[model samples]
Target: MKHALILVALLGLSVTAVAQTVREPDGYRMDQYRGPVPDSLTGGRVLDPEAAHDLWQAGEAAFIDVLPRAPKPKNLPEGTIWRDKPRHSIPGAIWLPNVGYGAIAEVTADYFRRGLEQATDGNMDHPVVIFCLAECWMSWNAAKRALEYGYSEVYWMPDGTDGWTFFDYPTEVITPEPEP
Candidate 1:
């Protein structure tokens, strides 16, 4: 009976592993046009805001937000006050907007590579935490790229800004400088 139980356990483990295998649309990380997000990313462990916050507070991790900036409204009335929206992210998190979308334009690709290098100071072993809004793929792609770039430690915050705000964690606004 013990041997039979062990065999059954092994079968269950195999089934679970097969079930988690990456699939078509989810597996494909390079879609420029907006589409459905994958349930999982290729690399990095999924992290929550609380844990990320702990890491940030401990100064053991670098945080990055990959959300794209919203375009300014066009065709506004002549007297419209064009106040820029408040750009907030996890405290101490750098906002690198154009790095994650798959199949991006060449210019964007260059920007991403440069942004990443700048973020880590070219140190691939930096413990980096990446995030975006919930249900967004940009973070996933960016995390995968960081791993591909040979970062020893990469964490993906799947809950994103929503999760951070949900915990009533304070956020800070960070304006990204124009690329040189």
Candidate 2:
């Protein structure tokens, strides 16, 4: 038991160090999110792909994809066929668009809070992982929001889904339902 506890503590420290050292990729804009992000969220930690994969395989976390759903392009001369690009994410990640990606509106915030409650069955201690595209701020905002909502184990996957797939991690296609 002591050894396990020690190992966990060391991992926590390592994650913190990694988070602090992470630099935003070139061309990342702060104006993108237009929301405050603290240096750290008390119980939330930043995770690399390996750490995220471990949690995923172990079923120890709820993975959330905060990437916004692409809007259908406007303007068609007549009948130009439009097809969506393939939608894929780390296996089992829930697609929760609009949960983050700028200052969250009140309605969307309420919806996200409720959805999160249902997702975790109201268990605040359930581990939750939030992610989006590499260098995207959406995942950062969502992860911080989860922490603010009292989730004890929030993980921000800064490397995003593409990073996971880049490493040859298995991915699953997810078809999001149309919102009413």
Candidate 3:
């Protein structure tokens, strides 16, 4: 009986350790951009697909897709053709690729700020929905950054286009806003 109790205690400790390791970080996620995400954001609402859909139908929110663009290889042979990957996102969403990384360059930061200003028409109170792919940390980082930028109404749709399309919601191909 003592041995059985010790085994149960060890299992409990293992579960607790795993849970701790998976908790959300205090700051941006520095790496592993794709993985499970927390269910909440400190200064923004964490939205599910249904909630995002409702917001979309309301026409009062601006959806921003932050899926990163894959840059062309610099090592490709001269004359080798390279094509950019196509991305499909929720209709009417503004694609601001590469602006969601945990750490961003000054130019990228300017682009993100400018994109937000354009999306909200310079209204900080306008509702902004930020996303990328499902289980992507880029959205989380971007949402937090939006909050820091004094956006009063920010929503983080962690499931992003994956969740959006799962319900047969329509999507459209979008080009990223040019970086400054």
Please give the ranking of all candidate structures by lDDT, highest first, separated by commas: 3, 1, 2
Candidate 3 C-alpha RMSD relative to the actual structure: 3.9
- Give the TM-score ranking, best first: 3, 1, 2
Across residues 136-168, which tens digit of lDDT does each residue of candidate 2 receive? 777877887788778888898877887798889
Clashes within 3 Å, all models in order: 0, 0, 0
Best-matching candidate per lDDT = 3
lDDT for position 40 in model 3: 84
TM-score computed on alpha carbons, candidate 3: 0.87
1-180 in candidate 3: lDDT tens per residue?
Answer: 677557768777654445434566799988999987888899799899889999999998999999999998889998999988888988999999988899999889889999999999999999999999998999999999999989999999999999999999989988888876
Residue 86 CA error for candidate 1 (Å)?
1.3
What TM-score, computed on C-alpha atoms, does each candidate reach? 0.74, 0.73, 0.87
Residue lDDT tens for model 1, 44-111: 77787899878878988878888877666999999998876777888877888867777677777667
Each prediction's RMSD to truth: 6.2, 9.6, 3.9
Model 3 global lDDT (CA atoms, 0 to 1):
0.90
- Model 1 spans with C-alpha error above 4 angstroms: 1-39, 73-80
Highest TM-score: give the candidate number. 3
1 versus 3: better lDDT goes to:
3
